[model samples]
Target chain A: MTPPPAPVDDFDLHGYVDHQLPPARREEVATYLAANPEAAARVADYQSQNQALGAAFEGVLAEPVPPAMLTRRRPWLGAITRIAAALALLFTGGTAGWLAHDSLLAPSAIERTVAEPAAYAHRAFAGEFRHPVEIWGDNEPHLVTWLSSRLGMPVRPPDLNQAGYWLVGGRLLPARGGAAAQFMYQDDKGGRITLYVRTGIIGNSESRFQFFDQQGVRLVYWVDGPVGYALTGPVDREHLLHAAQLAYGQTKR
Target chain B: MDDIAQQISEQIPHLRRYARALARDRTRADDLVQDCLERAWSRLHLWQPGSNLKAWLFTILHNLHANQVRKLKRALDNVPLSESHLSASTPATQMQQLEVKGITDALQRLSEEQRAVVLLVGLEEMSYQEAAKVLDVPIGTVMSRLHRGRERVRQLLADQGQPVLRRVK
Candidate 1:
């Protein structure tokens, strides 16, 4: 009289291991595996394979991008390369004043620290329609508290309603052996943007907004006190800068 | 930088990662990425804006790698697994090194189709649909390739006498 278990096979097993199955179906697969030892062992093996692959190649992500790739691909980056070389020469015998001037003129390491990861995270998550964030914007208070504690500072999602974008939600992301927070925003017509914030930045006394148009994703980032903020969106530089200014304004208060 | 160039530059790290995994030699992998970037740059008009740029870039890399393979007409990895003997200097690091080397060997042993599916889904963390698009295969094909690829990797690791996951039950 009990209903027969749902038919599960290799496809379902792969889905279960890859976490591609829907929640309800995932639960069903879990139940099926409970009674099936062979399927369970296969799942274990698949899981380990994923972990091993991740362990093997993760270092590639941290490797410094080849200089030629960046400069040759975009001839304009050649200017930055020249500036960087000049800065290097200055470092040997330059005065502190020149050092500060060079910092303002050329893109520094701090900019890359904030923008690169922010750009990557935006590309990875901004397109997701389902499970876009760990916590929804509706739980604003709790979200603020949780992110603040984890980041070891008082974290707040900047209100961009004035700029026609409202907080959709946010999620915590790993950043350089520490925790970073990303807040997602949505406007009418479903245009999405993300504000990435990280604390404990060294040598980050303060910096004005720096603009970067990485591919099509526009970003405006700055350092304030102990934290760095990057606002990334698919919008143009003007619109992204407007939203970033709003975020910058709100966070300052 | 121009819009297209900036976008292409953004994907260099990921391209290098996938290429390194596929070619298994840093120099060859880097050359492949350079070729991919050049190809993408030349055909910038074909890349539709607002579409999946990462997938498009990946497809370019995949195609270049395929052509290279055809020209060479040799095995992707000529090095045998036996050559990667595990060192015994440090137990803690040795175990992880052994596992890493073992997985690399296992990946090289897989068929090109299976390896592409495995690395796309496993290393790049692409969804089944995305992996299919990049590989120019159907979703079902992606699933089957992933299953076989993962299973073969498991068997290869077990055969290597390296540490593998054991069933709890």
Candidate 2:
């Protein structure tokens, strides 16, 4: 006579579905499931759920890994670059010290002025193919001079070619009760990002690095001296933060 | 040292998949994965070198997601009348496989505990023991959660008048 059929519980069924059961127990559960159509249907349902989940998210595995997530390649280099750049800026000026020291200050009025408008500007223009900016990047010197004169400060668009983003163009908008400069950049994949800048006395202490997300657009804003800068994009935080650092390094006085 | 980094890098795709299933929002999912990677990188030395790096990374991510959920809940509770409904939208057109849409929505509706168990066992294909270790729970809990979660999902789909997706052996 066949040995008494092994008792199969929900755990056994789940184990069978997940392939976690050993060969012996798996066969036992299979026998039990064959005898019970309800259990068999439940097993099939579980298997389909697993398949659907796998099929649903399989695309992310094939999509290109975000550059910010590439820790294996440039993990230490990112930190070293930031530190070296920060040190370099330290000797050139006290901006680095100010950044670290004044981060504890209260929220600046400048954040209100810069973040929202910058996010709106980026959303409005980053996707605009024909008239993305008032001044195209074809003439860098003229664009810089024009923006600097209008904003009453030196306006330099940080070169993000190393980060795989090329200078697209720039435009000027009214912000912080004064002229604000907006520079656009695009990647080879057609992804666009913007840098918004305005100069104003944001009380006594300036911000370190502030992150704000508005309607899917990411804005990283900070204040240095008389100028407030915000980097806006639909990019990931790491990539956007890296771009912001590059902008910070290049725009230092 | 370099070998460990390579191994960890290889798991990024898996982590991304798991995070996507858990967070249900692409941006939040990537953010969770990024946070996991950064944390894992910083604490690499404490990982005992050779023992199940993927599990370790998943634990870090799971814990981070839990903390974030708790914080978000507290923040939401403080708001008398929140604009939370405004953000409860999904991009329906981006779904490549329309059939799986109901399954995904049903998965998201599961309680966080049940959802975690289902994804860990079902999506990530982790063993009961491995899933329990990552979740810091006993194997019994994992089993019960998986059963309840799967049954609930089936009931939810049926309740919506959507046929339960079937797979024949």
Candidate 2 lDDT, tens digit per residue, B1-169? 7788789889999999998888765665776787788778778879987688888999999998786555434322322221232232334553445455788878878888999999988888898888999999999999999999999998988887777666555
lDDT by residue (A1-253, candidate 1, tens digit) is 9686579989999889888999988999999999999999888888878787777788887899878667544444544664664565456532222223222322334444566667667766776789778899999999999999888789999989987899989999987646789999987767778899976554446657766532233567888865789887656545677788888888883
What TM-score against the true fold does each predicted structure earn? 0.51, 0.59
Clash count per candidate: 1, 0
Deviation from native of the Cα of residue A15 in model 1, angstroms: 1.0
A10-124 in candidate 2: lDDT tens per residue?
Answer: 8888889898888988988988988999999988888888887887788989988898788443467655654654465468653223232222222323444665567667767
| Lowest lDDT block of 10, candidate 1 chain B | B79-88
Which residue segments of model 1 deviate by more than 4 Å? Answer: A1-5, A72-253, B1-6, B74-99, B165-169
Q: Which ten residues in a row have the lowest lDDT in candidate 2 chain A?
A: A100-109
